[model samples]
Target: MSEHNEGDLFRQFVGDVKPLKQTVRGDKRPAAKDTPGLIERRRAAQELGNKEGNYLARQEHISPVKPWDLLSFKRDGVQHGVFRSLKQGKYVIDATIDLHGRTVQQARQEVFHFLRECVERDIRCATITHGKGQHRDPPALLKSCVNHWLQQMDEVLAFHSARPQQGGSGSTNVLLRKSQAQKDKNSEKFNRKTSRK
Candidate 1:
């Protein structure tokens, strides 16, 4: 009974007191600066990007496959009928570029840039009119350059001389490989069709 009474007295004594405030911290370390190695690495990456950007902005060297001659190539393992279809002008031409009288340098840049855009837009078939170099003493300078450049790019699946209505041998019809996105979309459709069946 005495112990219970003492306990009640102690609780009453402690109940009215306020709690103490917490101590706020005053000192904090500042954020870390980049180390010397990190800074050097960042600078090197930036310089490389600038160099590549400059290379793209200016002339890209084009090695002619063969000067002033019919030029053609296809990456190996392409299905046999694909090239033949292009040669037959079976694919509808989705885009066209005329390179008449442009310098080889200008034509090279334009052709690459245009083809890049075409692939992005999912264009598969295009016609490039390089002109037969008819009036030139040598003949077919742009034609040859265009041919060589097209062969060099992996995007070009096949090309052949267009018919009389399409500028004949002077202008080549090009078949570009389908973009990966386009191919994936087609595969998805195929899968869906098979799944339904």
Candidate 2:
């Protein structure tokens, strides 16, 4: 309230306030043209072919199969083997077939046709839902048939009972080879040109 007291308060406020400085000092920085340490590490990896020698050595331990080793015909001399289940997830189809209405021979034909078409169309994986043997009076006909049919098909790369959510033991997930058309289309797309900016 008094002029002396107000002057003293103003002096205290001025003494507490600090002035700002805006200059920065540092070591000379590298330009954009300079390669980082990561680049040198990558260059060294490229020179070594990123462990290709180790991969080749492992491959050498395994026996190689030749073109002549493969059967000449699609169905000729093809061995039948059961593929219990599949591990990978991305390539899978969930499909169901009604064997109840059809006869044994008819059901077999339908399954064969479906599998053939899947292979021709390049369907990598599919689920064949032949319901559980719960309702069958005798042994489960469709289940047994599907098991045998899958083994006979040459195009079936691998197959296994689907997971519980996908029908479990009642359903099978089949993996088929890509058709020639699919391979050609993929190669063509891969060989596509990019425009220069």
Candidate 3:
């Protein structure tokens, strides 16, 4: 065949040839021990995970903002001295978040996440501006929501509306729980000081 016909002739020759069947080489190795039991266990675990995900989805919405007494809320714990300190504006706030015009939902998430970050950084004090809401019927919706959400977190040790220059009715100053690491460090320092004396 001429060079031009050589390509078509090659294609025809190849097409006429029977194709080889592919054989999947099965493993000659021993069967995996407890294969059926393992598969069953994996299936059960996945089902349980899906069930738990659905259950958790239903239980979401920030785990419900528990009934909190805003009037008596500032005084709600064992740290009378600490609460007094917060009320008295003794703690130097290291971080501050301004929630001036944010919606209640925005404020709640910001306050929660902000407090967690403060705790992680070992920051003891923070201030949140939750708008006094002078125009609103009741007043200070963000303030009240911040108060509720703050109490819900395990990190918040104490919080009180700030002194006038610090936003007064419009903001709150917070104290975070001392992490175990800080507590241990403090105890070690105290023990050393006492031993020296």
Best by lDDT: 1
For 68-174, candidate 1 gives per-residue lDDT tens digits of: 34545667876779877877778799999877656666666667766776898999989998877766744566776676677777788888887667877777888
- lDDT string, candidate 3, 1-197, tens digits: 69879988898879778888999887675644657975575456446545543221111233322222222244356468877788888989899998765566445545655676688788998888776666664554555666657766778777777888887767778888877788899999999999999
Give the top-scoring candidate (TM-score).
Answer: 1
Write model 2 residue lDDT over 33-84, tens digit each, in one string. 5258845644454444444331212212323222112111123332332232
Q: Stretches of candidate 1 above 4 Å error?
A: 1-70
Q: Give the higher-lDDT candidate: 2 or 3.
A: 3
Give Cα-based local distance difference scores for all models: 0.73, 0.56, 0.67
Residue 98 in model 3: lDDT: 84
Model 2: lowest-lDDT 10 consecutive positions? 65-74
TM-score of candidate 3 against the unseen true structure:
0.57
